[model samples]
Target: MELIVLDTAEAIASRAADAIEALLASKPNAILGTATGSSPLPLYDELTRRYEAGRISFAQVEGFMLDEYVGLPEGHPERYATFMERNLRSRVDMRPGSLHGPDALSEDLQAACDAYEAAMAAAGYCDLQILGIGADGHIGFNEPGGPLDSTTHIDELTEQTRRDNARFFDGDIDAVPTRCITQGLGTIMKARKLVLIATGENKAEAVAHLVEGEIDPRWPATVMQNHPDALVLVDPAAASLLRQRH
Candidate 1:
C-alpha cells in the first residue's frame, strides 16, 4: 500500500487522476471500477476536465459501480445509478450504457447478485478500482463484522451509514434505502490495482485504520492493507489521525 498525503483534496484528485490517465494510456479499453459519494466528486471532475482537453478518452472503457441502493425506483435522484450517470458517465467520453451497477431492484435479489458476480467475472474483474472510505471504515457497503471474502450480495445498511448518507436524501434518513447490493471485499481485491480517495476530518480515523492498523474485519477498509497494489490519497485533514507518516 502507498500512502500519499496531499495538501488539498484537489491535489489528491490530481494524483488519483494521474493513475487513471496512466492506465488509459496503456490500456484504452481498461475496465474501471467506480465509486460514488462526495469524496470522489473532485476526482470525477478532474477526469471530466482531462476528457474535454483530449488528454483522455473513455470511449471503449467499461465501468462498474461499487454498490447500489435497493428499493429505489430507477431514475431516483439519489440512486447510485443516477449519481454515476450524472456525475461521470454523462461528463466523460465514455459510451452511453457503459457504466453499470448491481441490479438492486430485482425482486429476486439473490439472483441479481449472482448475475452481477457473473458479469464481473466475465469481464475479468477491473484493472483499477476507485474507492472512498466511509467514516465507519466500510468499503463498498461491506460494513464491519462482514466476512472479508464476501461476493456480490445484499447487505443491510448500518445505521451509521444511513445517517451519514441522509444528507443526500435531503436530510431524511427515511428516504434512504435500508439495503444495498455491494461488490464484496473479495470482488474488490480481484482488481489489478486500487485507488482510494478520502478527505475531511470525519474520515481521519478510518484512514488511520486503513493505513496503519492491523488487518481486521472491524475496520473493513483495513482489508486494503492486504492488496498487493493499492494507493491511498488524502488531504491533511483526512490524514490527521495517522500515527506514522510513512
Candidate 2:
C-alpha cells in the first residue's frame, strides 16, 4: 500500500491520470474498474481532458462500475449507471455499451449479482480499479460487518452512507435508495492494482483508518492495506488526521 498526499483534488486527479495513461500505453485492451461519487469526479474530468487531447483512447478498454443503487429508475439522475454515463462514457471515445454495471433493477437481485460476477470472471477481472473511501470507510457498498471475502451481492446501505449520498439527491435523504449491488471486497481485491482518491476534511478519519489501521471489518476500506499494489491519494484536509507523515 502506498499513500500520497497531494495539494488538492486536481493534483490527485492529475497523478491518477498519469497512472491510467501509463497502463493504457502498455495494455490498450485492459479491463478497468471504475467508482462513482464526488471523490472520483475530478479524476473523471482529467480523463476526459486527456481523451479530448488525444493522449488516451478508451475504444478498446472495458469498464466495470463498482456499484449501483437499487430501486432507481433507469434514467434517475443519481443512479450510478446514469452518473457514469453523464460523467465519463459520453465524454470519451468509449462505445455506448462497453461500460457495464450490476443490474440493480432486477426482480431477482441475487441472480443479477451472480451474473455480474460471472461476467467479470469471464473477462478475467480488472487490470486496474479506481475507488473512493466512504466517510465510514466502506468501499463500493461493502458496509461495516460484511464478509471480507464476499462476491458480488446486495447490501443494505448504512445510514451514514445514505446521508453522505444525500447531496447527490438534492439534499433529500429520503430520496436516496436504501440498498445497492456492489462488487465485494474479495471481488475488488482481484484487480491487479487499486487506486483510491479521497479529499475533504470529512474523509480525514476514514483515510487515517485506511492508511494505518488493521484490516478490520468495521473500517472496511482498511482491507486495502493487504492489497499488493494499492495507491491512496488524498489532499491535505483528508490526510490531516494521520499521525505519521510518511
Candidate 3:
C-alpha cells in the first residue's frame, strides 16, 4: 500500500484523473470499477473536463459500480445508477451497454447478486478500481465485521452508515435504504489496481485505520493493506491521524 497526501480534495482528484487518463491511454478497453459518493465526484468531474477537451475518451471503456442501494425506486435520485448517470456516464463518451451495476431492486436479491458476479466474470473483471472509505471504515457496503473473503452479496447497512448517508435524503434517515448489494473484499481484491481516496477531517479515523491499523475484518478497508497494488490518496484533513507523512 502506498499513501499519497495532497493539500486539497481537488488536487487528489486531479492526480487520480491523471492516473486514469494514463491507464485508458494505454488500454482503451480497460474495465473501470467506480464508487459513488462525494469522494469520487471530483475525480469524475476532472475526467468529464478532460473528455470535453478531447484529452481523454471513455468510448471503449467499460465500468462497474462498486455497490448499489436496495429497495430504491428505479428513478430515485439517491439510487446508485442514477448517481452514476448524473455524475459520470452522461458526462463522457462511454459506450452504451458498457456500464453495469448490481440489481438493487430485485425481489430475488440473491439471484441479482449471482447475475452481477457472472456478468463481471464475463466482462473479464476490473482492471482498475476506485474506492472511498466510509467514516466507519467500510468499503463498498461491506460494513464492520463483514467477511474479509466474501463475494458480491447483500448487506444490511449499519446505523452509522445510514446516518452518514442521510444527508443525501434530505437528512431523513428513514428515507435511506437499510440494505445494499456490494462487491465483497475478495471481489475487490481481484482488480489489478486499487485507488482509494478520502477527504475531510471526518474521515481521519477511518483513513488512519485503513493505513495504520491491523489487518482486521472489523475495519473492512484494512484488507487493502494486503492488496498488491493499492494506492491511498487523502487530503490533509483526512490524513491528520497518520503518524507517517508521504
- CA displacement after TM-score superposition, residue 106 of candidate 3 (Å): 1.5
Tens digits of per-residue lDDT, candidate 1, 37-70, equal 9999999999999999999999999999999999
- After superposition, the stretches of candidate 1 with alpha carbons farther than 4 Å from their true spots are none
Model 1: how far residue 224 lies from native, Å: 0.9
Query: Each prediction's TM-score against the native?
Result: 0.99, 0.99, 0.98
Q: Which pairs clash (backbone N, Cα, C closer than 3 Å) in model 1?
A: none
State the lDDT of candidate 2 residue by residue for 11-106, as single tens digits.
999999999999999999999999999988999999999999999999999999999999999999889999999999999999989999999999
Q: lDDT score, residue 142, model 3? A: 97
TM-score between model 3 and native: 0.98
CA lDDT, every prediction? 0.94, 0.95, 0.93
